[model samples]
Target: MRAAVVTVGDELLSGDTVDTNASWLCNRLDERGVSVERITTVPDRIADIARVINEYRAEYDAVLVTGGVGPTHDDMTMDGVATAFGREVVHSEAAEEWLVEHTDYAAADLTEGTTHLPAGARMLPNPEGVAPGAALDRVYVLPGVPGEMKAMFEEVAEEFEGDHTHVEVVRTAEPESALIDRIETVREEFDVTVGSYPGDDVRLKLTAGDPETAAAAAAWLRERVDPA
Candidate 1:
């Protein structure tokens, strides 16, 4: 499955916070063989969040949104998602019950805004925090806090099917320039994507539809590129 990530927060855009959620989600998705097509960071604007959700929802199989699920005024991801899908925001009964049972917050203490969600959306349980995550029409709304996000994601991780195939090789003595042409040729030949990075020496990464294809491309590149 192909997925896109949307990280929402003024803090992220302002560089006050690093978007570790995107990288972590991508890695987990990759481990399950899912391909992450793109990741976007946006400020805590409702309209902008809706616009991005509408755009990515059409292009990717799924869109995972992190951030803005808090009780604070800037947290508008749930409402934005509802608006994007032309749905109404309502208190989720299941989510409300879950909160009452699992959290320290009483029903009166939970803000009405906190319980509001897109109509017909399923609540993704959050073990780490009081605010629950939500899923609607292939879009997932998650907490911005790293710990809460990770816990909520684990609850719904099984819902996604990833099909990514990757192979990485470290070439200690290889000159990057020497392997450029051959790498490009192999990429075209296998109809796969290849990436080269200079580290202590050189590292080549090949990604394809399946393990066989990735292994074949890696082998071909290894033969043509002189390993140092």
Candidate 2:
């Protein structure tokens, strides 16, 4: 399965907050055999959010959206989502009950800001915070907070499973330049994807859909290079 990530926040674009959510979600999706093909960062604007979601949802198997869904004014993700699918924003009774049962907030104090969601969206209960996430039309909206995002994602993690990839890593003392020819040879010879990173020690990573193919490629490269 393929997925796209949309991280919404002005803070991310301003570099005030690192977009750890995108990377974290990508890694988790990778482990679940879901390849994340695109990642986008947009300001907390409903139009921008709606545009990307509309585009990505059409192209990928899933679109994972993070951030800007809280009770704050800048939290416009839910509104953007409703606009994307032409759904009306309505109060989610399940979300309100969750707050009353799981949090200290009383029903009388709860406002539409806290309980409203896109009509027909499935509520993904938050295990760590007040605002619950939502799932609608293959668009999974998650919290911007890392802990809450991670916890909420786990609740629906199984839905993203696909063909798993096996990876093998090899470290070499040789420079990347010295290994270029060998890297090309192995890449051409095996059905594996190779990545070479140059650092104190050159690191070669091989990934393939089959475990034996990945292992064989790694072993073949190991025989030709000096191990670090």
Candidate 3:
């Protein structure tokens, strides 16, 4: 399956917070055989969040949203998600109960905003934090905090399964100039992708729909180039 990831937080846009959530989600999604087609970071604004969600949901099988899911004012992801589907933002008593039961917070400590969600959205329980994840149709809303996001995603990871892509890596001391012809030959001979990265040691990555294809492509290149 193909998916898109939208990370919401003004702090991410301002460079105050690094967007590790998107990378982590991408990796996790890939491991589950879901190819992430896009990664977008939006400020904590309802309009921007809704726009990206609306655009991405139409194109990908699923849209995974993270961040801006707290009780605070900047936490506008829920509202944005609601707006994207033209759904009403309703108070979820079930979510409130889940929050109360799962967390140390009392009902008195919570606000209507804390438990509010898009109407018909399914709650994804959070074992690590207060704000629970929500799933409405193809959109899955998750918390921005790394731990909370990871925990919440694990609960829904199975929904995104597809054919897995296998990767093979080759670390070589040969420069790009030395490997260009062989790389091109491998690309033409195999149904795989080859990426060359220049570093202290050149890194060659071969990826394909199956392990055998990737291994064959890597072997083709390794026959001509010396491994580091």
Candidate 4:
């Protein structure tokens, strides 16, 4: 399946916080044979979050969102997701029970916003933190904190399944200018994407339909361009 990632945080946009969630989620999805189509970082604004979620949900098979699940004022991801899906936000009893049983804090410690989830959404357990995540349709709303996001993702990893192709990189002495025509030819011949990066050295990346296709492309590239 192809997935889109949304990282919601003003800190991420301002460079105050690194977007580790996107990278980690992408890697995890890749291991499960899922492709990440796009990743976006946005502020805590509800309208922007809802717009992006709606747009990507219509385009991709799945959309994974991170951030804005905390108790603080800026935590608006859950509400935004509910708005995007045209659903109301409600407190999840299962999530409340999980928090009461697992965490050191009492139920009263959880802010009203922390327990609210999109209506009909499934709760994804977050052992690393108190706030639980929600899954509605193809959208998975996760906690912004790296620790909680990783834990929640691991708990629900088995629920997702998809197909993915492998990519192999080929570096050669030939400049990208010399290999542009050949790269285009290979792309047209095979069901794959060929990307060329030129800098101090030239690097060609072949993303093929499968492992065998990647091998064949690598061989073809090697035959045409000598490696440095």
- For every model shown, the clashing-pair count is 6, 0, 0, 0
Tens digits of per-residue lDDT for model 1 on 88-150?
A: 988888888999899888899898678878899998888998888899989999999999999
User: Against the true structure, candidate 4 has what lDDT?
Assistant: 0.87
RMSD of each: 2.1, 1.2, 1.3, 2.1
Model 1 clashing-pair count:
6
Measured with C-alpha atoms, the lDDT of residue 175 in candidate 3 is 82
Using all chains and alpha carbons, the TM-scores for the candidates as numbered come to 0.89, 0.96, 0.95, 0.89
| Among all candidates shown, the one with the greatest TM-score | 2
- The weakest ten consecutive residues by lDDT in model 4 span 184-193
lDDT of 3 by residue, 136-170 (tens): 99999999999999999888888889788899998
Off by over 4 Å in 3: none
1-228: candidate 4 lDDT, tens digit per residue: 888999999999999998999999999998888888899998999889999999999999899999998668889898899999899989888888888888876888877777778999998888888888999999999999899899888988987778867888888888778887889877876777887888777888898769888888888877888786
lDDT, candidate 3, at 147: 96
Tell me the spans in candidate 4 whose CA falls farther than 4 Å from its real position.
188-191
Residue ranges of candidate 1 with Cα displaced over 4 Å: 164-166, 188-192, 209-213, 216-220, 223-228
Cα lDDT, all candidates: 0.86, 0.94, 0.90, 0.87
Compute the lDDT for candidate 2.
0.94
For model 1, what is the C-alpha lDDT against the true structure? 0.86
